[model samples]
Target: MNLALTVLNITAPVFLLAAVGFAWVKLGFEYRVEFVTRMAMTLSVPCLIFVALMRIEAEPEALAALSLAALSAYGIVMIACFALVKVMRLDVQTFLAPLIFGNTGNLGLPLALFAFGEVGLGYAVVVFAVMAMLSFTIGIWIVAGRGSLKRVIQEPLVAATLLGGVFLWQGWQTPEFLTNTIDLIGQMAIPLMLITLGVAVARLETKAMALAGFLSLIKVVICVGAAWLAATFFGLEPVAAAVLIVQVATPVAVTSYLLAEKYGADAQPVAGLVVASTLLSVIALPLILAFVI
Candidate 1:
């Protein structure tokens, strides 16, 4: 009973905030998602990452281990997803990236913060940073047939991760006033991201939901299994392992739909993925949290 309540307590606010956005859109309110996403990714999320990484006191060895584990997990997932796509004869351009990259940023971060507090956030950010870097690079390549290394370098979130890592490594702290300001900016990230996720889902149009649902279930199983194996293989600490699993098991990101639309790779199927996977997460994430937490 206590465990169930704890899981609910941790997840309620995150989904409730998203529900607010979903309801707002249903009421015919205007939400410029592109603007919100740009601001969050460019400013607020960067601030959040920089602050979290800068302030985290976890052992450097632990952080390094988690980083490598995350990388290896994603690599393994990529290989597994590739084989699945081949067997199903799905489009490499449309199906592969969405399957390989989950919604580690908007959903994963807040869930981690609520489920495991600041320590979880610390580990979650590392995974988010890794996903962001890869999504911008290889994920993009899969969709567009060419990777944009320049775009990856120009991304504010990438810059923040690199800079925050340096600060953490050197044991440096920003001036008190500056830190406070950055902290304030960082505080906007979670709520904004959650709401934006809801808004994105509410706006998307999907077809082939049956196929999407089947794939989504497979994705959850594969992602969670791969993450667990990677965590155990790498000997990750308990918190790190739990955070890694949650991050990897998140739903297909709404960004996948946008990329498919932009690259002419069949946006409808991608939209189906985004919608189906997200709806599945409503049931899937909480159940995963029940075990992981």
Candidate 2:
């Protein structure tokens, strides 16, 4: 009961405020949403990631648990999604983005912070990093149906991951002044992300929104079941497994719409999925946490 109450206390206001922002845009102030999203994705988000990575104290046991959870949650999901496309007889591009493009970084990262603090997030982020690589390079390739090897490897986030890995591996300490500056800037990620969602929601067409809602429902069931089962089957510790599940349980990534739009890979449904998933994720996350933790 205490744990449940703590979860509610932390999430309730955040949920309400996000709803208010979404409603405000739906009623009016659509432009503000776009501004927030742009600000968050381009600037604050990267800083937040960098800081999170730097702060994670890599212990051998927890690190191993995190890796196991990440691999189990993400690896299983990706494989299931691949098989799903063939089974459903769906177009690869249209269906693939909905299945795999989870908001693991933006929304998932914050939730991890809330649940596991930095320790939990460290595991979640590593899982997200793996998913990002697969989603961006392989995901984009599959969606586009034909992209150059260079194009696949050259995405901004992919490059960031590669560079960031080197930095982490080098064990070069980030100066306090730099981390402080990044934290100041990175603090903007949450608000910026919220406003962005609101604006994006306002722009969604009615039919597309309906489809996205459908996908969001599907995502909730799939993510929760898959993550929990994977964690259990893999024998991960409860808390570590919960982090992986939380990251997977998040709705579609905010970046999914942008990727779809940029490549012309059925942006309308993708955009709708982002909105629906974001909303649905609140319910989905708590349920999974209850079960897993």
Candidate 3:
């Protein structure tokens, strides 16, 4: 009973905020997704990452282990998803990236924060950063048939990650006033991302629900398995292992649908995957949390 309540407590705020966005859109309100996304990505999220990394309390070795574990897990997931797409004869450009990359930022970070507190958020940020780096580089390549290192270099998230690492490594602290200001901005990231996720789902049009559900199931299984293997192999501490599993097993990101639309790669089906996977996570994430916690 206590565990069930714990899981619910951790998960409720995430879905509730998302529901607020969903309801906002359904009631015919104007929410400019592109502008919100740009601000979150370029400003708020970078602040969050930098602050989290700069102030993380874990040992540097632990963070390093988690980083390598995340990279290994993602690499394994990418290869497995590629094979699955080929076997199903799906369009690689449309399906592969969605299957491989989960919604680590919008959903994973908050869950970690609620479930395991600040240290969990720190661990979650490491995984999210790894995913973001790959998504911007290889994920773009899969969708557009060419990757741009220049674009990756220009991303604010990338800059924040690199700067955060330097701070962590050097045991440096920003001036108190500056840190407080950045932390205040960072506070906007989670609610904004969760609401944006709901807004995106509300606006999406799903097609081929059956196929999307099946693919979503497969994605959760693959991600969970890959993350588990990597975590075990890397000897991650309990909280770090749990965070990695939860982050990797999160549902298909709404960004996948947007990328498909932008690149003209069957956006409707990708939208279906996004919606199906997200809905599935309503049940799936809580259950996974119960087990992991």
Write the candidate numbers in order of decreasing lDDT.
3, 1, 2
| Model 2 / residue 91 / CA error / Å | 2.4
TM-score of 1: 0.98
Poorly placed runs, candidate 2 (over 4 Å): 30-38, 60-72, 147-172, 208-215, 232-235
Local accuracy of candidate 2 as per-residue lDDT tens digits, 181-279? 988998887666654555565566534667667767876777777888877776777666787777777788756766777777877677667767777
- Winner of 2 and 3 under TM-score: 3
Q: lDDT of all predictions, in order shown?
A: 0.93, 0.68, 0.95
- Candidate 3 residue runs with Cα over 4 Å from true position: none
Which of the predicted structures, 1 or 3, would earn the higher lDDT when compared with the native? 3
Q: Count of backbone clashes for each model?
A: 0, 2, 0
Q: What would the per-residue lDDT of candidate 1 be over residues 226-260, giving only the tens digit for each residue?
A: 99999999999989999999999999999999999
Tell me the alpha-carbon RMSD of every candidate.
Answer: 0.8, 3.2, 0.8
Best by lDDT: 3
* Error of model 3, residue 94, in angstroms: 1.0
| lDDT measured at residue 105 in model 1 versus the true structure, 0 to 100 | 89
C-alpha lDDT (0 to 100) for residue 117 of candidate 3: 91
